[model samples]
Target: MLPDISVVLTTYNQGKFIKKAIDSILSQSFNNFELIIVDDGSIDDTKRKIDQYSDSRIKKVFKQNEGPSSASNVGISLAKGAWIALMSGDDISLPDRLQVQYEFANSFNYKICFGLPIIIDDEDNIIPDEDFPVFFSDHSFSNRKVFKRLFEKGNYFCAPTAFFQKDIIEEKNPFLISSLQLQDFACWLSLSKKYDMPIINKRLIKYRRHANNISSKNNNGRMEFEMKMIYKNILNNMTWELLHEIFPNQFSVASMNDKRCFEIEKSFLLLKQSIKSVHEVGCEKIWNYINDDVMCSILSTKYNFNYLDFFMETGKFNTNERDESND
Candidate 1:
């Protein structure tokens, strides 16, 4: 019989915590599921530890050290369930994670579901739950207001805590497996366009923030990659009219520089989309664009432009001159 859900986990050099990750899944309150773990070329004893688990529900695929994006793509491709709960090898999910998301998706008919994540340090100490901003139940998910909120800040949806319908990803083909970083944000931006974003509002996953994480080590590089992804995949695809309606904060020259970086990224994706014949203008890009310059500027500056204000005011195009102040 087919399982009710599929848990897709990707790992690289996670031997230290892979056991905890796997055990958490096995001990889940929701038992009727399959666990697909992709060991993305670990040179360590991660494989040996995985071998220690012999449950029939666990399936392991070994691949060369590709990246999380590729590993996840492979996992999703092999998933037989209608829903896939994305997880990481270094993190632990709450026992009720799948059960809660499954019930919410079933009752609400949500295509994608996200949740609040508890941040934990390498020593497994709770850092602070307030990393995620306080959210109201009536927050906008189906309209531009939602995208506006996301652009106003960084990613609000914790990737591992989120579960999505396999079919939604299959249909969009939005993920580019070649990218080793920012894959989660790229995928979420695409999903936001086609479906109403759902938040589980529960702390379902422990997001382990440690020095060993690939993201922590090459943060600047990852930010560069994310900026490139946004420009190619999201900004250029949006028409000036739609962008004005949805991402007005990007109008200023300075903001436009930021938007232009996204535009360049979108431009790249547009070229590929047209070439591949997967072209369709989304309602809005639905994702914020970032570039190396913008990323650095963001490091120096306090925040990006205000989305709601940018939407209402068209003349507020941020001039590129202001970026000089950053230098």
Candidate 2:
């Protein structure tokens, strides 16, 4: 029988946690789903453990070490369900996770659904005193509040807990395999732009934060790289006029910060292009941005102007900052 959903999980050397992760899906209240496990060149007993599972609903894909994004893409390409639910090899979904999300999708005609998640330690124990929600509720991710929050504070939803319509990914061509890093953020940002991101408040998955996990090991580096691309790809695409139209108050500050950051980069580039270009018409464009009361006020408080000073002193923009550069 064709499954109602395709649960795509990418596994590497997660031999220790793979069984528990797979078992969680099998034990789900909603059983009409295919558990698609893509083993991305696991050198450990990860594949051996998967071989032990005899369920007809389980589909396994093997590939060389191409990273999670490529594995997900392969799984997505082979998926045969109406919805594609994403999970990590180390994460565990609650028994009712799919039932709840599936019901939400069917009831509201939602194309994408995500929920809160409990942070787990290496031992698979939930964080101390973390109150996981008992029931699911509505949360609109596309609303200005949610959008602004996501953009300002960074990613909000639990990625492994997300369930998106298959057609959406097929149409958007989600998950760039080349990123090797922050592929989730890149895909999510693309999806967010095209669809109304809806989130459920219930904690439906246990997000494992282990030393061996890709994210845990490269958190800072990956975040910096992702932020740089987000600024260039997402923020740079927005016009100042459009920003004011979409974001009114709280997001206005974020938009101003984005604009200033862009202007600063542009000015630094122009300064490097030629000393004479500093007097060009485009050079004055930077002043126009700085002249904005809100941007100037914010910069007055930010002491890290090394980005601006680099070009002024050395006549070239330094890719490295006192802090790591995002891209």
- Please provide, for model 1 over 77-172, each residue's C-alpha lDDT reduced to its tens digit, 9 standing for 90 to 100: 899898999999999999999999999998999888887778788778887655424332234667466555443343556778879888887443
Q: Which stretches of candidate 2 lie over 4 Å from their true place?
A: 129-140, 170-173, 211-218, 235-244, 248-327
lDDT of 2 at 258: 76
Mind giving the per-residue lDDT tens digits that candidate 2 earns over 1-327?
A: 788999999999999999999999999999889999999999999999999999999998878998888898889989999998999999999999999999988898878888887778879776642332221223655644444444444455667988988988744347866576567766766666557778876779988876554334365555555555444445446555544544453234444657565455444333333223222323444455456776555445552443264335443334343222111
Clashing pairs in 2: 224-326
Residue 310 CA displacement from its true place in model 1, Å: 18
Worst 10 residues of 1 by lDDT: 318-327
- The CA lDDT at 41 in model 2 is 98
Report the Cα lDDT for candidate 1: 0.66
The backbone clash count of each candidate, in order, is 12, 1
lDDT of 1 at 218: 56
